[model samples]
Target chain A: MEAQGVDVVVLCGENNVAYATGHAAPSQEPARAGATRTVAILTRTDVRLLTPPPLDFDDGVRELAAAIGDHAGTLAIDEYPSMLVHAALAPHAPVDARPLLTAAKFVKMPAELDAMRRAQRINEQAMDDVLPALRPGIRDTDLSALFFRRIFELGATGNTVDPIWNVLPTSLADGPFTFTGHLPFPLPAVGRVLEKGDVIFNDAGIDFNGWASDFGRTWYVGVDPDARQRSQFRRYLEIVEACRAIIKPGASAWDVAIAAREANGGQPPWFPHLYVAHGIGTDSAELPFCGTDLGAEIESQVIFEPGTVLVLEPVVWDDGHGGYRAEEVIVVTDGGCELLTDYPHAPYE
Target chain B: MSKERVLDEMGRREVDVLILGREGNARAVSGAHRLFLAGERAFSPGCVVVAETGAVHVLSVTDFGVPADAHLYPPSWNPATLVGRVAALPGVRSAKRVGVDGITPLFEALLTAAVPDASLVDGEAIMRAARRIKSPDEVDHLRAAAAVARSTMAVALNGVARGLDDSGVVALAMEAMAAEGTTTAAFEPRISRAGQRVTVAVGVLRDGWEADVTRTAPEVDRPAELVAAIARCHPGVAVADVGADVHGVGCGYEALPADERLEPGMVLSVSVAGAGDTVLVTEDAPEVL
Candidate 1:
């Protein structure tokens, strides 16, 4: 903050608040999250949190003003509660704190990495309980039930995404029409019954001590993958290896994105609306986004520093047949990168 | 029916356009089942409602649960790009008043730059006014959500009986809720054990409506203060008199003004501190769901 000449920093996003103040409440839907939101304020010398009662009843403007206590310096905030727009922060012309926060969260410390690893371990172990039941005639929500139960039992703090067990159609035309003309993925689970030859794209996440874990895989129902499905998985693995080969301490996100594209025959092997890879920490998807619509200029600027954690998810779509997809978590190191995800590509391998 | 109500409210409030970032507000207006993500998303125009055309434009990449005629815009990581997309919506350029449920400094600046003539106001108030009174079908959805919550609470109680720890009991309850086909929880279960008594607060969202309840294991008697507060849940009763913990329950934990009078069709979740129940205000009596 001193380096940027920012005197006061206010954080309103739940994960950002947790990052700044070490205070956490139960994870919730957006509406409830707004009603029960907390704010953390940090000055050059002190950090304070305005929580509950006063913040709720008074709309947080008065409470935030009181917490700041007359520092009359440049203010920066990740989000602005509009009630405070003119009342509390307009005078300071609060600037966007996202860039500074993003830079700070770009690389993980040893403790944050350990917490993320623990989170992923719990996620994988819970999936261990969920996969055995992935037979024909099971509802999508049934898998979610088992995974949710096991994660909490394994000491997970929160469930991040709503456990996607999306069944893919054979071709792009058979699926819902997407604006990008590419494959649509990761639709929310709606209790659809599994059929004999369904191809399931699984994605879910959980949190352990404020760190997030993302788990994704492609599963075959009731039988082993056919020849074409195995080939798709091989292509997916090749794309992942191509990206992994260039992920080093000083590599730009563009390098990794280009490697994946070249391996996939010069086409982006990821969802159009989504990314080939994303960074994860307190927030499920944070900085170091690779191959997103944020534009190529920004992607080139996001350089990988040592201790940067990335979730590389490459989708290998065979237009006539169903596709293959999975997520691999890796941490960039001085020597190269180390894999954090330890799940198997069972049906394909 | 809900969209008509929103349109009516928009006319009454004299707001020409609504750019909603809150999921509950977006779901209420668009009737689209977008993906459920936990925590606060950075402010962006997730849904846009135009008064002139009565059209709902949702920020969705695919037409999964979206209405066929609704305008769709793909997701962008850049706020400037999103602002440009929203600006291209019909009747947005000439809108005199634009309401937003939430805003950030960057978003507000971008919106102002995009539509320089429109005045930004509190769209959240308009949404609350439209959603405060639940229709019969909305009430039915709320009742269904309440049943799921209560069933999950029962599973948590069962875990407490088996001497499981707090997280273990939460696990059992969450599993039970998902088994009932409700995968999204309203919030993480707040369970803590002190001595022989355990307090369990569980909430769930089925479709879009919400049901939240708090209870104690081993069945402790309801406190007199809570009972008195719940008794005031009747038509024409001021919400402040009802209690601070009492909040309107519908798509989300709807916020009602403390000075506002309780209406007959409104549903309320009264949590006096921690233990409470959801009730329906009627012409004569309040029925507990």
Candidate 2:
């Protein structure tokens, strides 16, 4: 929000609320699905949090209030009882802090950056363990279980999201696509054994310490690759490499995306492409997305800032085959960007 | 023997033999020793006991198929075949099935088919009572799982910064965990914005269980003052009192205590929210595992 020049940020997302106020509650009712009605007000001189009764009435809130009281005056809140803030400040004059308090949290600080880094490290470890277990004859459900177990064993509080396993046969007509694109579905069974020539794609990520990391990779299950598969894989890799090549401190997101599109010769009926890359840090998806059509310029954009983290994915679809996508996480540095993933770009048998 | 003295009087009972089912029952009866028919069935539900002098016999009804040498048939199956088989077994005195409520209906049928005159026993409470104490191995697993959770938090904290979206942050965190060899997250990561505050929820499962542990870091402006207030939150003070004096709380985890007293053993996740910044504190040192 600070980077975007927006003040008095009003966040409705659960994770965002948690990030700003340090208090998050599980959705008590169904209507609150995908919504957590917690609010944090940050002003230059004071910070206030306004939340539903479920979250405010806790010892943690007491502790938070004490922490905030040391810093500023004139506690301002929306729904919280004004009396509570006033009573908390006995000797001091009660100041209404609504507008000014809401404007302060738009900027990012160093300590928040440190916390996010720790979250990323935990996520990377989960991916490392999951990649090797991708083989034939393993049930997707079992794989999911293994993934959960591994993440726990590795010391994460729990997964922030569901593990996704997609196995596609070399013959695209056979149809290995099984995801329903819904939540809470059971893991797929490993009923069919992996054949000698098959391509398996696994898209997975983890949530650690209230932060999240998501990445995708496609692997060759067996030794042989036909000409089409090889060509497709090569093109995908080329685009990924090209995307990374021009990602510098000053490069525009538009130019970076156009380079990828041009590399594909402006193929007709352009593959259903999402953003080439998105900012990642405290939340899983940030702003300043890399795409051709967005009116926002890439220069000095929020997404391209130094110290920003991003996920870069290049995708392509073949009529005979389903689709192929490869993604990686990169942290924008002063000079360029550093790739955080170790999944090999070369074909593996 | 008194009910409480059952373990002390194990050998004093008149019954010569004892039979138990698989898994839970097998463990209760033998304490880590494998039963004779361990490998025969997918789910174990059969136990047979042969008595001596003035003897007692025990049988389990969960058995689907058994050798001809066995004297009991599950009650639900045909009684005639069970009687004929029991009568044919050598030195079989009185054959009976152990009847227990809460047993699956299918097992009850098998027991009824095998033994017509079996004694029913209510052992559900006894079985449950036996499992309350944690074994040495169980404790070790719990501690190990907690350690794993702590370390994963470290990895997550490393990549967090301003401007990253929820999905991007979660993906990076997961990548860090994967790099450390974890294949899954414990729970769904919650990342969103609520009225100017950015929130991140790190949910990780530990030791085959999901702990809905959450941490919230509210973005704030005055870091120095927030830090001063947190520094004052020592043992034996009301957190609410502290908040009354401080301007705001930084970002971290929130716990609602049942009482006003803060004890040493109790774990509390503390968040100090400031403008654009948040800090997390816990009884455990702030370092990622």
lDDT of 2 at B130: 32
Instruction: Supply the DockQ value of model 1.
Output: 0.71
Q: Write the per-residue lDDT of candidate 1 for residues B1-289, one digit (tens) a residue.
A: 3788888999999999999998888888887888888876666889999999999899988989887767788778888999999999989988899998778878888999998899888787788889888889888999999999989888988888899988888899999999999999988788877788888988898987899888887874566766777788989999888874888888877766678899998999887755888888989878777
- List, in order, the clash count of every candidate structure: 0, 161
CA shift at B184, candidate 1, in angstroms?
Answer: 0.7
lDDT per residue for candidate 2 within B115-134, as digits (tens), equals 55654343322332332223
Query: How would you encode candidate 1's per-residue C-alpha lDDT over A200-305 as one tens digit per residue?
Result: 8899999887789999999989988989988899999999999999999989887888899999999899998889999998999888889888767889989999
Off by over 4 Å in 1: A52-59, A84-86, B220-227
Positional deviation of B286 in candidate 1, in angstroms? 0.8
On the 0 to 100 scale, the lDDT of residue A13 in model 1 is: 83
TM-score, model 1 to reference: 0.97
lDDT of 2 by residue, A184-248 (tens): 11123233345544566665555455555665766665455567777787887777777778776
